[model samples]
Target: QCIIDNVVDLKVQAAITSIVSATLAKAKLLCQDVSARGALVSCPAGYKPTGCACGMGCGSWDIRTDSTCHCQCAGIDWTAARCCKIGV
Candidate 1:
């Protein structure tokens, strides 16, 4: 009885693992870097900004509408955003 239960558990685990692997193989995270010569930059369509960086020694920043990166510093030279999206 114990051996039969162990075998059944093994089979269930295998099935769960295969399902997870198949789902992971079908979906992927695609990322891109966008930069511009100004205080603001935006991710491309269908992409969202995950992080941002600013030039001219500026550290203050924010994301506008979940897409654009805005640097809150005067005389800012550039801004960049790390954008990502999920795709199959």
Candidate 2:
């Protein structure tokens, strides 16, 4: 009976550990996703838009005007800029 109890206790402990580990992994993923979203939202101009249609083709850069950095998108023309479809 003592050995049986010990085995049950070990199984319970293992299950609890698994749950805790899974929860931690989910939390970590959430945090990373939030961080990435924030970075994309606050990115400077000329940096590729996070979800732009043109992908890396839409070169992005930050133009330092006075004391602040302004984000700007780059392309061959207005159509090229439009092609990026930023924020769409």
Candidate 3:
């Protein structure tokens, strides 16, 4: 009975792993970098901002409308965004 239960558990685990592998194989995380000469930068169409960076030694930043990166520091030289999307 114990051996049978172990075999069943192994089969279940294999099925779960197969499903996960197939899902991961079909999904791709695509990323890009976008930068601008001002305090704000926007990700390209169909992309969402994952993170932000600012020039002039500034670390204060936020995302606007889920697409644009806005730097909060004064006299900022540039702003950049790491954008990503899921693709097949």
| lDDT (10s digit) by residue, model 1, range 1-88 | 4798889899999999999899989998999999999999999999999999999888899999999999989999999999999997
Q: What is the TM-score of each candidate against the true structure?
A: 0.72, 0.27, 0.73
Measured with C-alpha atoms, the lDDT of residue 27 in candidate 1 is: 100
Candidate 2 runs further than 4 Å off: 1-4, 28-88
TM-score of 3: 0.73
Clashes within 3 Å, all models in order: 0, 8, 0
Q: What is the lDDT of residue 27 in candidate 2?
A: 56
lDDT of 2: 0.35
Best by lDDT: 3
What local lDDT does model 3 show for residue 68? Answer: 98
Q: What is the C-alpha lDDT profile of model 2 across 1-88, one tens digit per residue?
A: 3798889899999999999888766652111111121112222343332222123344453323322222244422211111121231
Q: Model 3: which residue pairs collide?
A: none
Pitting candidate 2 against candidate 3, the one with the higher lDDT is 3
Worst 10 residues of 2 by lDDT: 30-39
Q: What are the runs in model 3 whose C-alpha is more than 4 Å off?
A: 1-23
**Which ranking of candidates, highest TM-score first?**
3, 1, 2
Stretch of 10 with least lDDT, candidate 3: 1-10
